[model samples]
Target: MDRDLFRTVKQGTRNQARLLYHRLVCRLPHLLAVTLLLVVAPRLVSTLSLAALWSEARANAAVLLAACAGCAAAAYAYAMSRPRPVYLVDLAGYKPGPAHEATRAQAIRQFGLAGGFDDESMSFQKRMMERSGLGEATHFPASLMSIPVDMCLQTARDESEAVVFGVVDELLAKTGVRAEDIGVVIANSSLYSPTPSFVSLIVNRYRLRHDVVSHNLSGMGCSAGIIAIDLAKHLLQVHPDTYALVVSTENITLNAYLGNNRPMLVTNTLFRVGGAAVLLSNRRQERARAKYQLIHTVRTHRGASDRSYGCVTQEEDDAGHVGVSLSKELMSVAGEALRTNITTLGPLVLPLSEQLRFLATVVLKRVFRADVKPHIPDFTLALDHFCIHAGGRGVLDELERSLKLSAWHMEPSRMTLYRFGNTSSSSLWYELAYCEAKGRIKKGDRVWQIAFGSGFKCNSAVWKALRAVDAVAVGDTGSPWAQDVDVLPVHVPKVVPIDDDEASYKTAAA
Candidate 1:
């Protein structure tokens, strides 16, 4: 009892100290100004008296006071003109219920029986999944294999509703923020949209206010999550004291590639069912309760280049089988996109020393025409954590090499891919949840989330944690990895052979 009381007292004291520090930091400019005035007031008065210029001194003092008043007014105006702080109050990832779980063997069996693929296609898909870095536990719709091409509407609606409702409901429940309070709604899904649109569906389902602004984004691919956040940030900046809800997801059932085109088949093996809903607020009242502050968002589009634009394209193959084809040039295009994105984001987040070095390298390369390669500023110097999109094994490997991230740093992306597969835009959120579940995030730590998408686009969102958060306290039960998080970072082999019967069947059919 005595030890418990002592511990409580110590914690209270620490909390008080933290409060005091925040107060001082917020009022630092005012404190400095007051200190300067106190230090100089006496000397100024003495000097004026010694000069025997009382009348002139009084006149000068009046002018000086007027100037100070003008300056204060200007400062207040500038402060008001600045954008309000945007906070991520809370976020939730949709973990499809047990009914949707698809084992690798199940996926193979269903594909075989569905008659969507020939022997060659089946073998290729099996090979792709084996090397795809996705585990047997990845979620897929029960109707995926059974849904006919003409009945795509059912699959689209079912998948969209399941993910959208699951994530938004969880987010609202966690934050206790009513749907009516959400003034802006932005929903992004690469493949599916009905007449009402996904955003309208959300607003209608949640019974949001009549005035709620809604937008539905499509064709934005895997990076759409960051893009949606960027859109929300802008909307919140323009409309003050309002809540914005951003939902990122992809309709895998509707977009699933069933064609024999090898490039297009890749998407089938990579993408899985997932979605994330994030609640952002610019309200001053919620600052203390918010989990993270949006520090920076940068987006770059290299679509002007023909190769970059064509790297990831959705179209019908020669046989009229529609699918998204990922070209071999995707990695190189993505690398260029990332390089361009980081160039814009570096100045805002990178340390002064790193910036100076990068600037020097640029100068040498451009001005002197030297054989100097431009430096990639060490992003680790600016961010405590990185949530790179878990698009695929090759994407993760390339990013790990490009960013100079260690195995420990790349663990979240790798593990998220293994657990959930590529959830399109929402993949970053799953990666972030992985970090949180592992207890890697801490107060004041800055996390950088970077994503690449089908527009030949790369985008980034940097977040600073507002307060300490424990994975347990946040309740990880809703996460796909919640049950097995403790046993994660497990070795996933580069390839796993298909069952002996399935292999023989494929060989005979060929």
Candidate 2:
């Protein structure tokens, strides 16, 4: 009883101290501002005194007029050069029908029937599926799910076209935007970059304008989605009064590895059928209708280093079967890339107090050569929501620890993973859709979307909600989370921590 009382008292004391410190940090900038004003007010008063400045001002009146005119001209030029704000009008994430769902038991049974994998490889996949944070309802491409599997260029096209059409049709329906009105079209698919690229396919199907600026990004990996968004943002800035359509997906049909190579099998269990289409408009009139406004984007690439470059590579194995190899160094490279990205992003989004703290840490380490640990900025203070890529369970687990995010902040990512597995480049969008479905996004809420992929690139897109995103009706055909999101915030079984050797393998796979 005495020990319990002491523990309670100590916990209360710690909570109070934490609260007090947070309040102080919140007000530090204001305190500093007041101090600065007090210090500078005397000098300003003396300089602006009529007696002191009257003679100087009259003597330099002509010079002052010329300086004012020059300043005005410079301001005008700067304003003209500023980029237009990109508004995310709306987005649609493709929801696969009931026929596409890949239940866990069914997947394992099919894996055994398909053959080629050794007993060890078979067990590896079984274990991975059990702890992969993917639920039974996640969809796989119909072509690949067949007992014998039919993976061909035609099947790949079938999968890609279905995803593209599903999301784009839903997006157009909700936004009431005509395909002809789309001035820019950008499509990204890491693998299966077919002839009539995704951009060309979208343009031809929608009968988009002949002059539409189109870009097809291939082999950019999962991070390519945000990279597409960043590209669209820049295009919208330069090409005023236009709508940009960004399509992100990964076609698993042709990329699935049939060999017994353990490292390559990771992709088979993780990736699934998913895609997302986003509509961005630079038109001033769309601001009222837009769901969110693009605030900032930061991308970090570590591919220059040999280790990072070789971390994720598509190559033929010794047996002559082609697949994307997962190197053990992948997680290490990703961590470095993430660090570089968030460091660049911190100043752009972190609050004044957090910025000052981060700045102090930098100065102490770089300038003063102090031994203090580098401070991890409190990103939660800056961002109201976080949508980290749902690559795998370990990826989400590591990020949750690194960022000190609460379970609530991670729910969307976790739920998305459970529901969709890893949709590669399109996973981040599905996570965002989850937030929208839950109505967790309020006006002025800041959201951070971060993803890393092949080329060892880490990318972030920051968005500010323009208005409260209305919660979705259960089973809305437009959303991937339609069937089960209402039942979500579902209980995901926690993965047991693995040994070092297994951990590295899982990390690289993630």
- Model 1 residue runs over 4 Å out of place are 1-47, 50-72, 145-151, 359-374, 473-478, 500-510
Specify the poorest-scoring 10-residue window by lDDT in model 1: 1-10
Candidate number of the best TM-score = 1
Q: Against the correct fold, how does model 1 do in TM-score?
A: 0.85
- Model 1 has how many clashing residue pairs? 0
For 255-288, candidate 2 gives per-residue lDDT tens digits of 8887888789888788889999999999999999
Question: lDDT by residue for model 1 over 116-173, one digit each (tens)?
Answer: 5777888888888889999878898756745333237886788789899999988999
Which runs in model 2 stand beyond 4 Å of their true positions? 1-76, 359-372, 496-510
Best by lDDT: 2
Model 1 Cα displacement at 97 (Å)?
1.4
As for candidate 2, its clashing pairs are none
